[model samples]
Target: MSFDYDLFVIGGGSGGVRAARISAGYGAKVALAEESRMGGTCVIRGCVPKKLMVFASAAPAEAAQARGFGWEDATAGNFSWDAFKVRLDAELNRLEAAYTKGLEVAGVNIFHQRAHIVGPHEVELADGMRVSAKHILIAAGGRPYLPGIPGDDLGMISDDLFLLDRLPGRVLVVGGGFIACEFSTILNGLGVDTTLVYRGDKVLRGFDNDLRELLTMQLADSGIHVRLKQNPARLDKQGDQTRVTFEDGKVEDFDAVIFATGRAPYTKGLGLENAGVTLAPNGAVAVDEWSQTNIPSIFAVGDVTDRVNLTPVAIREGHAFADTIFGNKPHNLDHGLVASAVYTRPHEVASIGMTEDEAIQRGGVEIYDTRFRPMKSLFAGSDARVMMKLIVDEATRKVLGCQIFGPEAGELIQLVAIPITMGATKEDFDLTVAVHPTLAEELVTMRQPSRRHEAPAPA
Candidate 1:
């Protein structure tokens, strides 16, 4: 089949960009189309900017802790949202340019327009240009989702956070997921009266229960009003404030309301149906182990596939797809045992593999749980405590999961994930020498199970 290019990629997010670049490196004629920015959600609206905000938000707490170290005038000063926004925007611009430069250097044609599938092998751009390819890849990613309720438009999504002109005086964060929890802590630390309201009984629903409980306490200690089992029934704009009516008919007003309820795959109007590509019930593009859609010529990766929605996973999926189809190196991404981190103030939460709940459901499981005030926080007289937990399969003693809640928990989990990914067992972890005088040492030193459960026999 004669085509304009060997591969046509839609959506220049992490997945699409990686696939296009790698395919081009393999000497395949490739082209990529991006409707908006090059770096997509992670670099532009998500992880990068969110982490910077996390860093910015921690200054106040750090300053107060300096008093224990003999620094007198260490009180945190007023934060200027305007100043931070300026620098953040500049950094985003620089990152976008770097992505563009890399794509160009890789010999991938860049189209600064929205592209949609017109046929299995054909894509039409926003500028009325039609491009044909032997294969098409979709990596459109996902977007913040808001429920359909009265006056819901009064609320903002996560994407709108980066574009806010000024920080809100009193903010309400809606959702139980990591986004809601992280932003709640961020805003609270930045001196905003932050209230986090989730419909569920707890925040971080799928995480280890101990970690969730510890984070809930830490969030409360940090002055974030945590309201569980409540959802916004309606939102209305009253003057300069947003009036939120809860499901129980309780009303609260805030300067701004942000909904981090969930994310929906960005598959709307992409012509996937027209191309005979199947989509999941949640609107995610349906794909198999190799990220190939029902139509073999059309493939999808990243959040659009609704697989493991992490940015790094998406990038890996993209690389694997390119290698398999273009580089003659067949490979597939293993979605299991992927580590993740949530940036919440006063403490960070990170986990890999299954949660305690998940482990319990599988079969016989053993849990090693520990909670204590770290030496640094203890010496500083801070009430903050760190929680470390390990879930192991009882039959094999293989570590099924690890969860940590404390400073550098995210960084610690990355190293911990290496052994876990390599199928390290509980005995192996105990055999390792502990890194004394460190919070991570607890992972290696815990030799006793705090709890054990045996799954019910097959019915």
Candidate 2:
């Protein structure tokens, strides 16, 4: 059948833009539709801008430490929230222009309009323009979920945080997810009276138990009041301030409230129903390993599919989709060994593979863990410590996971992910020679197993 474009991709996020560019490179006529900028969440509101704020917040901490280190900076400069916000927008605009230029150079047609799936093989734009393609890809990504509560409209989601004209005087951030911790870290570091409330026993509930505990203590020390086992029941507006009521009959006042509880797939108005696409219980578009929806012509990836929900993972998935559908090379994404990082105060947590809890649940698991203060931290007068854990299967001696909470934990975890992805054994990590004067060496040199054969070795 004749098609307007060989491949028409909706949502100019990481997956959509990559798929469109790659498909076009393979000599296919490709058209990409984006209701907003092309860089998606990572470039827009999720990672890039968030990390920049994290870096900005770190400056004050560093300056405070400089006096003790004999670096004489008698005067400290005040950081302006207004100036940072303006500069952040300028940088984001530059990135958006770069993305647009990249797509143009790749010879892919770009559409700045909301796209809806019209049929199994057709998509309609907001302007009522319809395009029929041989294959339609939906990488529209996801959105922040705001709970139904009184004055929830006064609060901001992760997206809305970037658009704020003024930094909040005080922020009552509710949730325990990675996003919640991250926002709290940034706001607290920037001198905002930040209070974090989570319904769980601890923040970062799914992360390594040791790391979570260590971070909780560190965050408390950093002046962030972490209220655990409690969640917001309602938000009341009291003049210019927001008062949040917790389930446990606790109320706190703040200039703003940010709900980083979770994000939902942004497929509500995409017309997925008309195209015969199915959504999972989590409200994400259901897709097979091949990224193809129930209808073969329609495919989905990135946060929309609820698989991994990481930027690099999304990029790889998009590449695999383009290779399989357009280049005739089939590839499936392996979620195992996906590395993730959480930038928190006093510690940065990073991990790949299963957590200790997950390994123990599987049964017959061994854990080799280490906790120590780094050499630099000792002289730096920091009382913080680093924690590392390796979960291995007793039968095969294969390392199932690696988790760390320390300085440069993200960098250390990424290096370990390589071996984990290659199915490296515990012995492989143990045998690797340690690099002296480094924090990560503690991970490779973990000799004393924390948990080994709970009862006895299998006969």
Q: TM-score per candidate, in order?
A: 0.98, 0.96
lDDT of 1 by residue, 39-84 (tens): 9999999999999999999998898888877787898798999999
Candidate 1 residue pairs that clash: none
lDDT of 1 at 300: 92
- lDDT of prediction 1: 0.92
Clash counts for all predictions: 0, 0
Q: TM-score for candidate 1, please give it.
A: 0.98
For candidate 2, give the lDDT.
0.86
Tell me each candidate's RMSD, in Å, in order: 1.1, 1.9
Predicted model with the maximum TM-score: 1
